[model samples]
Target chain A: QQPVQSPQAVILREGEDAVINCSSSKALYSVHWYRQKHGEAPVFLMILLKGGEQKGHDKISASFNEKKQQSSLYLTASQLSYSGTYFCGTEESTSYGKLTFGQGTILTVHP
Target chain B: DAGITQSPRHKVTETGTPVTLRCHQTENHRYMYWYRQDPGHGLRLIHYSYGVKDTDKGEVSDGYSVSRSKTEDFLLTLESATSSQTSVYFCAISDSEGLYSNQPQHFGDGTRLSIL
Candidate 1:
């Protein structure tokens, strides 16, 4: 099944912070994050394993909670370039090579 | 960035006509996937191939068929195009070395398909 993402949309100003959450009903082996711009494909951000490690790229970071089967993406000092739709893909233990993604959270960062 | 390319970057077709979208990858990844993006639906997998000639249906596979006769190419076809099929199609590739490995997928620019 596909994961559920919170905050269908969000607007932020430059240098602000925002968080997007993704939760699943089943146990997840890993969580993958991607950002898609207008008329563009989704770009990989980072992947978090079941170990619950926190990963960051530039001002963006993410955390995976194995117990809760949830993941959150954190963006700090948001820039206008960060404006896009964020999606979280989940991989279950039984699903091999099949990643289910959430509906997505639209983020608009204004200058 | 993974050397994945999708043909017919933009297309507008009439209803009931057949359409095919091609995806080619130079990375030689073992896994290739076809997904459609819409307004409410972020990205739904239509079909996928694990290797040459090995394919499987995804969640929203109805009315869509896929073929992977070669390892470098994966094709998604719509037998009869409809307005509902108008959406941006994306092709993704991933190389998972081991069963337990966590390999992220790389996507192509995407093909904008408009069915009238």
Candidate 2:
């Protein structure tokens, strides 16, 4: 099944903070996060395993809650470069190699 | 763009015509995928490949087919294009499963297709 993303769209000023959440109705084996700017392909951001791993950068981070079947992407001190849509794709243990993506969250960061 | 290239960045075709999109990768990743992106719906997987001649269907596999003749190239074909099939397509590769499943996927620029 497709994952659900909350806060369909949000506008923020530079240096602000924003969080995007993704939840799945069924159990998830892993979660993948990606970002896409206008007219560009979706770029990989990070991946979270069922073991609750949070791979992140200096400003961007993500957490996976295996029990809740949910994941969250956190953009702290957002920059203009963070303006784009974020998508979360989930992999079910039973369905390997296939990922079910969320509807996406549009985030706009202005300087 | 990690060494991945998608041909015909933009295309406009008519219904009932055959359309084939090509994805070429230099990364030599073990896994590859084809997905479609629309306004409201996020990227939806159409097909994917694990190795040469090894392909599988995805969630939105209907009306579409795929072929991986070589390790570096995966192709997505629309047997007969329809207006409903008009959308931007993306191809992604990952060093996933068969090798490592936790790796993130790298993507190509994408193909913008429109059916008239």
What fraction of the reference interface contacts is present in each model, in order? 0.52, 0.71
What does the TM-score come to for chain B in model 2?
Answer: 0.95
Clashes of 1: 0
User: Candidate 2: which docking quality band?
Assistant: medium
Q: Who wins the DockQ comparison? A: 2
lDDT of each: 0.90, 0.90
Task: Enumerate the candidates' DockQ scores in order.
Answer: 0.64, 0.70
Candidate 1: tens digits of C-alpha lDDT, residues B12-116: 999999999999999989999999998898899899888899998888999999999999999999999999999999999998655432777899999999999
Q: What does candidate 2's lDDT look like per residue over A1-111, in tens digits?
A: 999999999999999999999999888888999999998888888889887675545557888899999999989988899999999999887777788899999999998
Residue range B1-101, candidate 2, lDDT tens digits:
47999998999999999999999999888899999998899999999988999888998999999999898999999999999999999999988755335
Model 1: CA > 4 A from native:
A53-58
What is the C-alpha local distance difference test score of candidate 1?
0.90
Instruction: Report the TM-score measured on chain A for model 1.
Output: 0.94
Q: lDDT (0-100) at residue A39 of candidate 1?
A: 81
